[model samples]
Target: MKVGLVWFGDDLRSADQNILWRAMQEVDFLVCLYCMEPHHQRPSRYATQGMSENRRRFLQQGLNGLNATLAKVGQTLFVSSMDADTSLNLILNEVPISHLYRNHHGGWDEQQTLKRIENQYPDVRIQIDHGLSLFTPSQLPFNLTGLPESFSKFRRLVENVDSTTPLPSLHKLPPAPSFNIHNIMPWQHQITDNHSAFTGGEEAAMDQLSDYFSTNLPNQYKAMRNELDGWENSTKLSPWLAQGSLSARQIKASLDVYERDHGASESTYWIYFELLWREYFHWYATRYGKQLFLPGGLTGKQTQGSYYAERFRKWSQGNTPYPIVNACMKQLNETGFMSNRGRQIVASCLIYELGIDWRYGAAYFEEQLIDYNVGSNWGNWQYIAGVGADPRGGRHFNLEKQTAQYDPNQNFTHKWQGQVYDSQLDSVDAADWPIYPTSSN
Candidate 1:
């Protein structure tokens, strides 16, 4: 009986996980492994920490949950701080392995890592499953290279295409092969006791989905999704989705059940529409490759801005002149979450108002967001910076107009805006700024 190894990357859950299911079927014994790379903890090029404390804490909770879940199925997840290649080498040397199974990711960095592994081990029977996206390349109506540049065109083509059904839940797994490997990486960060709305794990993700759909929230989602704050205002599923604790197909499956039971409305269908947007960005990342990360973005046009360190710092710390931007930034800095409309508004301010390099903002979001997906993060930044797929070239939101409409009563703004600090800018008069006066209503 040949031993097999399953490497868990972003795909952490056992439910709807094709890689884990197929590995269990083919191997007599299996070992589940995860690599905690040093690069993930270090500061990025933009000088922001690669992963924020909030996100790190969430990841730790998720890992602990996954280990407990695996233990129930007679398996254990071995975690190490070593690089993926070194970790895999240690496993192969210690145990006689015949198969390696992993979920495929569309990011350039992730793809490069897989390529390096293949080069190092030529004889291993590696099987890569496309579990990251709702639709795979082969399932697409056209070749990835020829994917439509505009999202609306792409959505029109594939809106009716059915997603493959999610894999059935696994209740048991083959016992892991015993191996003596030490030097397991210890989680050094302190888990904060901050009261967060989200808790990590497969169970939590499913519970959240069930709770949201069980209410009238889905029916009101289309109308309320743009609001600045509130749990019920929008479906808070991205964090789980980003970590692979929840799969797109799983969400779609739940949506199907909801629509059948409650009757489908534009709101019910709108959830599907948002999922398509996520799918578009996932495939777009693969097609564009390294260009997606480049300063020029997919269009190869240079963004018209230079890095302004002080200005960016003020924006990030929620000390900006605009109350709406400040409040949104404060919310993101405090909680590992922000509304979709808030994201667009802040992104527009960074690119158009502050005139800082877009990559810095994108990199900062990567560090801070609990639900950060490389494709969506970078792709959307490119769109706002006028380098990606927006027919209008770029998005520039009028801060005054946005605030008047979205934060009219100043309820959302007041909740997040803390004590005012000294202005980072030298000459700007705080009183002269057009922000909604804190003294008024």
Candidate 2:
């Protein structure tokens, strides 16, 4: 009897889940697991949390939703507060698992966990299926080593590639192996926290998908996508996409249906275009691996900034000299989200104006963003810092120009209290001596 154990990472929903569907075919009994690793809750060298209170609660909501989704089909999600390696060890010892299954993820730490599992349990037949990405690596037009260096080049090359289809929902799953999992709770156990503008879970993901396409919203997405505030300005499906409640392929499939039904426009096509950018970063993270986190990134070019305690603190707290940057930061802190344009503007301010390390900004986003993905976050940061995939070097947005263009009416700025009267950036100089505050002219 082949008893299977599947470790679920960001991909939580059981519907359109490749691993869950496959496990039932290959194993007589199965265990579905998700570990809420402690590392995510701790602080890193930058002094920000690996995960913030908002992020943690958002993730818990995903787990709770995934758990409930699985329960409807007679399966359960076994969650753990312990680290993944220990939990997998404890389960393998008791389950006699002959097979292991999981959705593929591009995170370095997640890769390390898979390696540990492989070495410890050579006898288990581990199978990884793709649902996280729109296209599997094999489906890519080129080898992973030959992935395009620029999003433009990448987009041009893959313009004709076929879209991927989402797997059908699993109506029923294999029974559990009946082995006791240590430090576990019933599937109904839930930890609720301050919910965000977006709910976390697959059901909500599908609901949002339906609601968005059910309207003329897709036609308007391109024009308003860059807006700083309006909720309907963008697809707003990212939080769910990041949590694996919604797959990239699922979104692509929906886009196809929407285009066919509503008629394709540039806005409809731009939706596809944005997804390709996401697809590029997913491959970018996969190809670069640990380099994605490095300062030099894929290019190995030296970055301009270093860590500055006070400037970083003020920038993060939305008390920066630049009101637009401050507004963007305030929006991020309060809502656990930021518009794409807002991210780039504030990222440029951190790297160029404040002269704080780009990694610090990326780490802060990792902590705060309800929609954080390892690849896109770091890759875009590297691009902003002029160290990553930008063939033309880094981007430095004109804060004044950006403020005039995006927040001309100052509606967004006023709403978020962007006009901070911070004449002095730091209270102390390098020598820890008192520095006179300057007047803002």
TM per prediction: 0.93, 0.95
Error of 2 at 310 (Å): 0.7
Quick one: best lDDT, which candidate? 2
- The C-alpha stretches of model 2 lying farther than 4 A from their native spots are 191-195, 429-441
lDDT (tens digit, per residue) of candidate 2 on 45-99: 8758578777777787888888887778888788877899888999888778999
Among these predictions, the greatest TM-score belongs to 2
Report backbone clashes per prediction: 0, 1
lDDT for each of the candidates?
0.85, 0.86
Report the C-alpha lDDT of model 1 over 1-441, residue by residue, as the tens digit.
878888887777888988878877899999898888778899888858778888887787778767878888988888888877778888887888888898888788778878987887787789988888898777899998899998999999999888889997788888987677875432233355648888877888889988988898889989999999998888999999998899999999889889999999999899999999999999888888898888888788766887776677778888887789989999999998999999999999988898889999999999899999989999999989889988889999999899989999889888997235445442345686533223311
Q: Where does candidate 2 have its weakest 10-residue lDDT segment?
A: 432-441
RMSD per candidate (Å) reads 4.7, 3.0
Cα-lDDT of candidate 2: 0.86
- What is the alpha-carbon lDDT of model 1 when measured against the actual structure? 0.85
